[model samples]
Target: MDLVERLFAGDKRACARLISHVENNVNGVNEDLKKIYKETGKAYVIGITGPPGSGKSTLTDKLVKLLRKEDKKIGIIAVDPTSPFTGGAILGDRVRMGDLNTDSGVFIRSMGARGHLGGLSDATSAAVTVLDAYGCEYIFLETVGVGQSEVEVMKSADTTLMVMVPGLGDDIQAIKAGVMEIGNVFAVNKSDRDGAKRTKREIDMMLDFSKKDWRPSVTLVSAIKDENVDVLLEKIFEHRDYLLESNLYHLERKANVKNEILSLVRKEIMERVINNDEKHQLLEDLSHKVALRIENPYTASEIIINELKK
Candidate 1:
């Protein structure tokens, strides 16, 4: 069997090697993904996101510890902002997750956002698929909280948790648009702080305003002491079970499949368009026209589409 087959056949070492290769975006990565894409969808992806400084990395570390107790193979994808100067992840989470990295059952990866929105890196969804096909029981995606793009990319998760802390103040309004409606669970970290209860009240009031069929539960937890960590884990499992019972699990997988295909298609077309000299020049000319207010991008796009069709 080939590398992809070996990974699906329970070869842990092969799985790790394949993932590392894909993360590097080496040639033939697309072929490798296509080969095993059909074998995926077994893992449950949990996306953890919230405003920065909300103790997300620490909470993820705690969650991994609790998950390991169930003898489940877990994969973690932590998305951090790229250094403006160096264009690499700040690597703060690597320092925090030092010991967890030593655990054989847990695989943790830190990805620089590389300018992706909603806190996820470009390859995150594919990485989640790789872990899923490799038979991981759970995959945790930690977002560093950029904005709408992070939420769009993370919608692939089976469930999404939005982490928040006290003292966001008026800046909290910045997150109101995209973060509120997307979270399946809301967590108030650093619950030991003075305004923790007030934050909970604020979230509860917001939930009351939501018309979602299943209310997203808000929980208070201190990741430093692992306080209420078990409760958080229980809620995660409860949400998972609820999805399964409601047949939403299958629907979620179907949605994920559609997103994956669309993402890949978008990437491929952009690549092809960039590589074609004629199309590249056409795009440049269209940009000039748009800048001059001569025509909009919609009409330019149609022109390119008609040309490509030929």
Candidate 2:
């Protein structure tokens, strides 16, 4: 049987292989995806994002363990920082979450961010689709510790959980700058650490100024000690329910599909028009012209685009 059929037949290896293909942008993968795309949207996508050393992996592990008690099928996509030399994931999460491999109900995959901005790899949404189609009830996307500009998870996930630990002074600034806008729920992980209550109060105070249809919930949880983890999970579920009840679920899904289509169109144009072998020399000549001040890049780009259109 083919990969899609195998995936539909409950084959983990097929799922892994298909995700790999999507990540690498392998030829004909889009066709494979089309075959299985209908099976998606069953899984609830949760995006987990925060700073480096925030124990997101550990928190994810704890959350998965709790969910598995109810026999839920879970998929984890850990967007690890790319290795400079190999251009592949550093695989830190794989090491931290290795024990979860014993559970057939849990599937973990680590994807290299590969310098893609917005804390997630370009293939992340597609990989999520693959897992969602594979019958996962919940999918956790752990981003590569992001900053002010990396708030794309809000667009991709049904719920966005921002994980922060106490003692990071910079995070206080980060929250005020833009994270406060994207996060659906705030988690003060490693609550055993000093200033945990202070951090929670700071968030609560900051949240007081903002008004929305659904207020974001802030919770302190010590993942290592398993303190309040269940509460945090429930908060996430509450956010999901709010989206569904408010009719934002359908709207958000519409926006997500629009973004995905636009992204794919841009990618296709970039590959077929600008990166074509026939255009390579033209691009180089335009670059030289621009470097010599004989032509500005705007006009050069227009020239390339017009030429391609003809």
- Model 1 lDDT tens row, 136-203: 88999888764444576446788888888887763355236666678888789999998888888888
Q: Clashes per prediction?
A: 4, 0
Question: In order, what lDDT does every prediction score?
Answer: 0.81, 0.87
Give one digit per residue, the lDDT tens place, for model 2 in 1-310: 9999999888999999999999999999999999888878989999998888888888999889899999999999999778777785566886667678889999999989887878898999899999998999999999988765688887788889999888877435745767657888999998989998888888877777777777888999998888999999999989988888988999998998899899898888778765687787888899999999999999999988887797
- Model 2 quality (TM-score): 0.96
> TM-scores of the models, in the given order?
0.90, 0.96
lDDT of 1 at 154: 46
Query: Whose lDDT is greatest here?
Result: 2
Clashes of 1: 4
Error of 1 at 300 (Å): 2.3
Candidate 1 versus the native: TM-score?
A: 0.90
